[model samples]
Target: DAMVIQNPRYQVTQFGKPVTLSCSQTLNHNVMYWYQQKSSQAPKLLFHYYDKDFNNEADTPDNFQSRRPNTSFCFLDIRSPGLGDAAMYLCATSRTRDSIYEQYFGPGTRLTVT
Candidate 1:
């Protein structure tokens, strides 16, 4: 069974507060990705964890970071969330880096920065 799960369907955080979003997959995929989507904008690829190697996008901000302690789990930590950070955080998994287009996405976590 291939499935991706994201905790806390909705979240609210104070401005400048740190928050974390988690994801896990039962598909045993080799690649896990984190995306950010704002209103009326397509999801932007923040980063990806692939087989013990972490890859960060060129434009990903320093305030955002990720940790993958193991293959099945990944976490996105926002060191100091700002109002601009309020958006839908998505987690996705793929069997291989080359098959990113075929990845399965989690329901997503909506973060509200107050």
Candidate 2:
């Protein structure tokens, strides 16, 4: 089926080390989004890519970054992994930026920091 897919569903990283999570889609959606979700908390929108344009949430930390080289691929880069940074990172896609459109989410990548 055409849908979003996240790689390395489980990730382990050392403190201060950099880790990257990847997302891809066969859906050919024009909008791609990245989110961080910690235990017992709501998913936080870190950033998104509307085609070639990048839009980041104002409150997003400098440690979080994203890259979308093309429509089919996107990546989340953690500059330095911290113990508190361990959480589920989600990737989502939408056909349009319109509020009425439904967003499709990937399974997510769980990061563990040691």
Candidate 3:
């Protein structure tokens, strides 16, 4: 079965600390998204990697960064995380840009900023 897996399902970091969450997929998808989901709220798109290209949401903070070294792996780096940054970090992948309807999401890494 095709799936996206996020490592370190739960992460805890001190305020102003840096953290990196990793997501790897067995689907070999071309488009990957890094999103943040707060309680009872929809996921907000932070950035995406389409093959080798990176696209960041206009409103996404500069503290958030993403890297996709290849089709199967993606990473999200939060520089100096604050308490407000605590949320579920999700990794989603679609086969193509037009196939947004068919995204496979990872279980997600729940981040906690102390």
Candidate 4:
């Protein structure tokens, strides 16, 4: 089925090391989003790309950066992995930014910091 794809479903990194997680979609959606979710906590929107325009949540930290090299792919770069950063990183896509369009999410990449 055409859907969002995330690689390396699980990742292990040492503290202070940089790690990158990737996402891709076959849905050909115009908007892509990245969310960080901790255990039992609601997912937080890190950033999104509306075509080539990047929209990052104001509260998102500098440690978290994203890149959408093209329409079909996006990458999340964690400048420095921290214990607090260990969580599920999810990638989603929507037809538009409109509320009426539902976002489809990827299975998610679970990060473990040593």
Error of 2 at 66 (Å): 0.9
Task: Report the C-alpha lDDT of model 3 over 1-114, residue by residue, as the tens digit.
Answer: 878999989999999989999999998789899999999999999999888899999999999998888889999999989999999999999876453557889999999999
Candidate 2 regions with alpha-carbon error over 4 angstroms: 97-100
lDDT of 4 by residue, 61-98 (tens): 89999999999999999999889999999999998645
Q: Which 10 consecutive residues of model 4 have the lowest summed lDDT?
A: 94-103
Q: Which model, 3 or 4, shows the larger lDDT? A: 4
Which pairs, if any, clash in model 2? none
**lDDT of all predictions:** 0.94, 0.94, 0.92, 0.95
Using lDDT, rank the candidates from best to worst. Answer: 4, 1, 2, 3
The lDDT, on a scale of 0 to 1, for candidate 4 is 0.95
- Superposed Cα deviation of residue 74, candidate 2 (Å): 0.2
Q: For model 2, how does the per-residue alpha-carbon lDDT over 7-113 read when each residue is reduced to its tens digit?
A: 98999999999999999999989999999999989999999999989999999989998889889999999999889899999999998645648889999999999
What's the TM-score of each model vs. the native? 0.94, 0.95, 0.95, 0.95
Lowest lDDT sum, 10 consecutive residues, model 3, at 95-104
* Top candidate (TM-score): 4
The residue ranges of model 4 lying beyond 4 angstroms of the native Cα positions read: 97-100
- Cα deviation of 61, candidate 3, in Å: 0.4
lDDT of 1: 0.94
How does candidate 4 fare on TM-score? 0.95
Which of 2 and 4 is ahead in TM-score? Answer: 4
